[model samples]
Target: MAYNCIVLVKQVPDTANISGKTMKDDGTVNRAALPAIFNPEDLNALEMALRVREQHGGQVTVLTMGPPRAAEVLREALYRGADRVILLSDRKFAGSDTLATSYALKCAVERTGDYDLVFCGRQAIDGDTAQVGPQVAEKLGLPQITYAESIQALQGSEIVVQRAFPLGKETVKCTVPCLLTVVSSANRPRPPSARRMIAYKLAATSLECPALLKQWPEFETAEALDRYLAERDQKIPVWTAADIGADEEKLGLPGSPTKVLKIDYVVLETSESRQVPATPEGASGLVRELIQDHIV
Candidate 1:
């Protein structure tokens, strides 16, 4: 049987490439110093969804909730064979913690509807809570399998997956209309297709289409440019909180209970370090010194 799948993806700060004034005294990340990239585990989730589509004959729809500039990841998804892409963007959705974020995502998923499966990364590096996917499942009233390493089998309405744990792994059976949180070990995500990359390099979301036309003027009207984009299947829909029917009270900062109390950086000083010989007397003396300094 053919199945429709939704893959939840995110564009996260490339922590590895972070540079220039990367930290503050309060311990908050300097987001401006980091370049954004597709979240690593989310790519695994996308790969899992695409693999399912290849096995069952279905389409993979990719969705992300972020600012309009996040369309960069959507275009990347298109290049990676996402049949449909949606961006949930709005200024009001800013400063959302996991609760608010999941609420918005649940609403967006409900708006899109008709999915046999939903896939998401186990956790986002920035948050590292691993809470969003399960929270979304609870909101949607669906069963969720987290830390899934692989989909073992699929039979009509039922599916089986292997969950990975720190020490070992276990298998699980669940019904469809369920969610799976993909782990990095799940599978290596495929690279974006070169042909699709070339074709969709200019793909634009609703917010970007008008500017593209204004900058190039090859298309006279928004309608004409939209038609042009539609013809090539390069138009990505951008939706606001209202578009997904999210309650204003339950979105953005208003819905978030968790607040960053402070950010701190711990610095170790090599100048404060002392070398001790690997001898009984040296170890005993070190311990004595530690005891004397009340550092034991």
Candidate 2:
């Protein structure tokens, strides 16, 4: 039996390079100040889905909700063996908290037809809430497994997975047509195929060239480019809230209850320093002091 899978991915600002300029006064990320890359754990999620497809004879579809330029990640997905890709983009999606974002994703997933599995990273690096996947599953009324470290087995409609925890790990068995929030430790993702990269280099979402042609004169007409891309079966489909039949009030900011009012950058500094002996007695004394001070 062949399984159908969807891998949810995100293109996130590289927080590792975060600086004072990373945030704006409006409590939003200054995306232009940071390089964007595929969310690390989402790659693991995709790799897991691909492995399932390889083992069971299935197709893998990768989907991401982001700006027009996010098509870069979609092309990257195609180069790495995804059977197809979708770009969920619109201005209304901007500034969405997890609730609204997941609602939109739920709508998109519903349109994708029935699937054996849906894979998402444990969290996006930007938000790190780890809520979107579960929220999407809730909206779809499907069972979900989060913090999935690895897949253990798959037989018929049931699948086993190793779930990671701080103490240790636990194994879980869930039926198919379920969702999983994948962790980076799940598997080492495969690199892009050079051949696929070369062949799919021209693949792009419909709005990509139009947005580019305005800024960079190197781009051709969106229509011509899309037509040319059609020949190679490489034109990516873009979806909007309306296209997916999402409720207007539940599509973006209005549907989101969580709002960031402000952002404060925290920095740690030593107010004072004290030397402690490396001996056991000295460590015991320090622990005693910490306990007395309630700083332990």
Candidate 3:
């Protein structure tokens, strides 16, 4: 019984390298100011999907929504063993909150035909809301298992998984055709294969034609380069809002209800310090002072 799996991935701004210029005055991410990298937990999700393919015999298709440059993540997925990669990109998808983002993703998932499983990261570093995966599941009307640590069994239509919790781990059993939001602790993502990398290095989306032309100046036009890539099955599919039949009103800024009224960066600095003695009485005194100051 082979399953058809789809993994949703993202290329997010490297939050570890964030600076003052990371956020714009409008409270939106200044993506141009930071380097973009594959989301960490999404890699875990991808690894899980790859494992499913290896074990149960299935195809792993990767999908992502972002600017045209987001196709880089899809290429990385190919190098890591994904069978198919698609990019959901358009200007209309800009400024989407989790709600709108999930809506668009739900549409894209539907476009991918039948699938027995969907995998997603627990959250994206840039937003950290941890809402998109569950939201997508809800929209797709599928059972969702979040914070999955590992898969224990997949027999017939039932799947058993271990989930991580603050207190401990819990085992959950759900039927097939469900969605899973994977945690980083699930499994270590495998490094890209050198052979796969060499095979897919030339794979690119139509949006990347301009940059490709710069490297291969022999191409008389971007169309010619696109033709060459297409001929070799290297052109990644770029889907627009209309391509996926997404509702315009339910996408982008118009669909987003959350508004950021302010953006502030908080920095903690010790302006003054007091040294308390290690003795019990000294500790008691410090506790009393903290209580009086309402610090605890």
- Return the top candidate by lDDT: 3
Residue-level lDDT tens digits of model 3 in 191-213: 99999999998999999998889
What are the runs in model 2 whose C-alpha is more than 4 Å off? 19-31, 211-220, 265-296
Could you tell me the lDDT of residue 24 within candidate 1? 63
When 2 and 3 are scored with TM-score, the better candidate is: 3
**Candidate 1, clashing residue pairs?**
26-263, 27-263, 27-264
Cα deviation of 171, candidate 2, in Å: 0.7
Model 1 bad stretches (over 4 Å): 18-30, 210-227, 265-271, 274-296
TM-score of each: 0.85, 0.84, 0.87
- Expressed as tens digits, the lDDT of each residue in 234-264 for candidate 2 is 7899998888888878867888898779876
Whole-structure CA lDDT of model 2: 0.88
lDDT of 1 by residue, 68-134 (tens): 8889989988899899999999988999999999999999999997999999999988768899999
Off by over 4 Å in 3: 19-33, 265-296
Q: Rank the candidates by TM-score, best first.
A: 3, 1, 2
Most TM-score-accurate candidate: 3
Pull out the clashing pairs in model 3: none
